[model samples]
Target: MAKILVVDDDSATRLLLKRDLKLEGHEVELAKDGEEGLESAIAFKPALIICDWVMPNLDGVEVCRRIKSDADLFATFFILLTSKVDLDDRVQGLDAGADDFLSKPVDPAELLARVRAGLRLYQSQLQLSESNRQLSKTLRDLQKTQAQLIQSEKMSSLGQMVAGIAHEINNPVTFIDGNLSHGAKYLDELINFLHHYQKYYPHPVPEMQELAEEIELEYLMKDFPKLLHSMKRGAERIREIVLSLRNFSRLDEAQMKAVDIHEGIDNTVSILQHRLGGIELMKEYREFPRVECYPAEMNQVFLHILNNAIDAVRQIHEDTGQIAIRTFPRHDGWVEIRISDNGVGIPRGLVSKVFNPFFTTKPVGAGKGLGLTISYQIVVEKHGGKLECVSQLGEGTELAIAIPIRQHRPPHSPSDSTPDR
Candidate 1:
């Protein structure tokens, strides 16, 4: 059924039209004048409008012109009702966007025929609009999928390369670490032998004494051990870096495991060392059990939140910026990690849109804007976690990430294998 509005100053004409349209199974609304008719058309968005040509304050042609001018009302069918029979008058009404005209004495059959044709046209317009909306949605979905695929491939390649580098470095580091202990032992025995030889033959030959002094033998004995110890420390630090790299690239481990949460967070920070040059990092960690999760995927999530926090603070304060990371256990099965920064914060109005796909505050070409979107899927979809942000504009931001100790392991997690930003 179609909704039609009839506007007329005459009470008899209005009632007559309403009564006849009702009998024909069309819903009809009565408007007393042109002004009231325009208001009703806007409020109800009727499919058709019939207005008297001569009404006080606003004429039917003026009403029709306004209706056609509005984009939202373009689908509405308008008809001009008048007793005027002049050819010029008909031309004027048509120019004002009137679809049909009715004589003042109004034939019921002609009115019904015009209403039927107008309703058919309105239905066709609605169907076409719906099709356009669907097409737009499809296009957006395709773009999102293509972008995600590209991101996933890039991360996968990076992970494989990192894993390879870590493997190569690990072999050499292991060789150096394994030899440092024995090397120190040999240096100590040689030193002790020389010391004993000096004690037994306190009076050495003149040539030997000259040689010892030339070589700074006493200082060499003390400093050589210290030098070896320093080398040992350096080797240990290299080993730590290799381990961090291996853990970060966790591509080799496809299955879930109970892993150290603090270590994962540390690995992510270790990889971002270059960008964290001047910022201060403060960590407050509680003694908690290792979490059961997908190590590679969860590492990416930590990277996203922490990286964003670092970026937020680095904007205003170069050397003075601070980022604090805190972790604690909840009474429930969940554990919470909060990354906070004392830098430029997000605006309140835009905070809710942070997780939307392709939404970024950064300028064009600076970022892909997919970091939080991918993070949201990994934490909430794959691991059954909660991620939320609290921020005050111009002050700072804090993002809370909470994940359960264990998960049900969702079946379809397309975005969990990669890093995105």
Candidate 2:
């Protein structure tokens, strides 16, 4: 049984509809004009509304227009009752959002059937709308999951390369360190022996001079220590960078844990050191708390952001551009890391779409735009943090990430969520 509102200017017509609809096991309400029908529809919220085309205050077409405008009220089935059988009148009624039209002197059986049909359509539309909303939500989740999976696979591949590169670099660095130490120690003994000779005889004695000449003391004493010290320092620095790269990759550790964030960043820089030759790199480190995170995933985030910065700088200058990386502690107990570069800044229009996956500004294969996108996921979704970028067209770009030291980290996504296959 449905609630039906009958609106008619004629008392006889309204009375007829009320009596006939009630006989069909429906609850019916009667209104005198279009104005009254509008008010009744708002107050009663009927399942179906039956209204006459012509009325004194407001006409049926106007009533339908007003109801339809209020989508909540329009959800109910609206049927226009009319005495004019002309095509024009029927067109006007339908245009006003009327679901059905019943001509004057209507058969009660036909009216009942039309009402049932409109009711079916209204329910079906509501169901379809709900289904569409669910489908859209599911699609979004799937896209996000797919993006995370691709990002993880890319990081894994990069990690393997980083480990191999670091290992290769370590060999030469170790050899250099050993040789420098040996040379430096030898230089210290020679310097002491020279000082003792100078003390024993204000100038070299005839016999001592002959010994010195035979040993080539002049050449050895001149520049040997200085050269060895310089070489050692350079090699040690390279060794440190290689170690940092290994720490950054963390290929052995897949699960999340507490990590010193600075080490991960240093490794990223070391691995990317070759690319930095064309650009000037600067960093300012601030005090930070140890954060619990997946070191490998976070290193990937660093790689992505730094890679973007490097690319941006490459645009404006052929060489000698600046990329600055700074990290500081925030009052909220979160850490803020910012990478800013004086490169070709992003255009105003392109800023909004940067985080969208597979969107690249580079020509064809030169770039895959997923760097910022994947970085955004790591900082914001995985670690319960935030990532943002500020850029101007010609000046440059600044990418900032803020993450809590301890957070309720989001679990692995469905796409990255694999089972033994």
Top-TM-score structure, candidate number: 1
The C-alpha local distance difference test score for the whole of candidate 2 amounts to 0.83
C-alpha positional error of residue 182 in candidate 1 after TM-score superposition, expressed in Å: 0.4
Cα-based TM-score, every candidate? 0.72, 0.67
Q: CA lDDT of each candidate?
A: 0.87, 0.83
Candidate 2 Cα errors over 4 Å, as ranges: 1-112, 126-142, 190-220, 276-286, 317-333, 338-353, 388-400, 409-421
Per residue, candidate 1 scores C-alpha lDDT tens digits across 235-311 of: 99888887888889888665667788998999999988778888999999998888878889889888888888777
lDDT of 2 by residue, 318-366 (tens): 7789999899988888898898999999888998888877787776888
User: lDDT: which candidate is best?
Assistant: 1
How far residue 321's Cα lies from its native spot in candidate 1, in Å, is 1.1
What local lDDT does model 2 show for residue 221?
A: 83
Error of 1 at 259 (Å): 4.1
Residue 187 error, candidate 1, Å: 1.3
